[model samples]
Target chain A: GAGVSQSPRYKVAKRGQDVALRCDPISGHVSLFWYQQALGQGPEFLTYFQNEAQLDKSGLPSDRFFAERPEGSVSTLKIQRTQQEDSAVYLCASSSHIDSPLHFGNGTRLTVT
Target chain B: SQKIEQNSEALNIQEGKTATLTCNYTNYSPAYLQWYRQDPGRGPVFLLLIRENEKEKRKERLKVTFDTTLKQSLFHITASQPADSATYLCALFKYGGSQGNLIFGKGTKLSVKP
Candidate 1:
């Protein structure tokens, strides 16, 4: 792929609903990352993966948020029991290697009502 | 704890003028700093990077300066155009093992007027 791609560019979820967002990273990109951006704020780190191995999940705000990049090419972020505070843009990015510049996707804008 | 700050207010500048943006950090000694440009409804694009050892880096109309001693960085756009209107973000990467995660500032919006 030329760039990272995310599915369902916009989503509106009801409170207590579960939502799943998907990301397709560029071909052969070994490093993938997830970030959450609130309105008018910078994107905050959520999780990161090196190939199929998820190296860091410390940035996830709570247990309700989960991300996985199994098989390395595609990734998914699932949120359980969505809350109003979970409304934000979910960003996905991919890099060729560690320390390389990232290529980002348009992101999925999640609105929890 | 570490924190990165960028001027939250929007900056208005005339076309062709050099636009300067600031990024400051505290309790961090990053090995590399990166700048990215983001437009509304689009993801951020990488602009420039400055290493801790390098004081300045330039790519065409973009120049970035990093001062580890001051814990600050400056991004300058030479001969700015309205096309350059976007939000600019500054991020830091740790020296050793933490390579994938990037700590980012809130970013400043630059609006260039013709």
Candidate 2:
């Protein structure tokens, strides 16, 4: 793909249900990041990966949030035991290098009802 | 913890004029500052980036100025068009704590009217 791509543009899961969000970073891009944007707010960083190595997962809200970028290409963010607060737009962005500008996907809108 | 902030209010300007948005931060030194434009219901698109050593950067009609001393960044759009209407976000790449992850501000909405 020309840019970052995310699967399941929209996901509505019942409270307590588990959901998985996928992100496909640009080919050959070495850096990937995941962010969560609540309505009316800017994106908050959740995790970052540099070629399948999770460098930072400190921004993750809780233990229920887990992200993996296995093989350094595709990444998945799994939310276990989802709650109403988990409802937000999940954004994936990638960059060729640490200082390069990021290219973002449209983002997956997750709603936990 | 470091924090980034942008003017929460929306900015309105006439077409062909210029618009300026501000980003402020504290508690951490940033290596670079980035500006992005985000339309409703969409992800942010990169505009311009300025490193701490550089005072300003320009891309066509878009200009950005970074002042590490002031801990602020200004985003300017010259000869603004209606197509330029969007929420403008600012971010910084911090070296410590989280290396590659960016810290973003809330963003300011810009309305360029024709």
Model 1 ranges with Cα > 4 A deviation: B96-100
Stretches of model 2 off by over 4 angstroms after superposition:
none
Model 2 chain B weakest lDDT span, ten residues long: B93-102
lDDT string, candidate 2, B1-114, tens digits: 788889666899999999989999998878898898899878899988899999999999989999889999999999999999999999988666563558888889899999
lDDT of 1 by residue, B1-114 (tens): 679999655899999999999999998688799999989988899999888999999999999999888899999999999999999999998844342558888989999999
Candidate 2 interface RMSD (Å): 1.4
Error of 2 at B37 (Å): 0.9
Deviation of model 1 at B67, angstroms:
1.0
Candidate 2 per-residue lDDT over residues A9-99, each given as its tens digit: 9999999999999999999999999999987788899999999999989889999999998799999999999999999999999999977
Model 1: lDDT of residue B52: 93
What DockQ, between 0 and 1, does each candidate earn?
0.69, 0.71
lDDT of 1 by residue, A8-95 (tens): 8999999999999999999999999999998788889898999999998888999999999879889999999999999999999999
Candidate 1 clashes: the total is: 0
TM-score of each: 0.97, 0.96
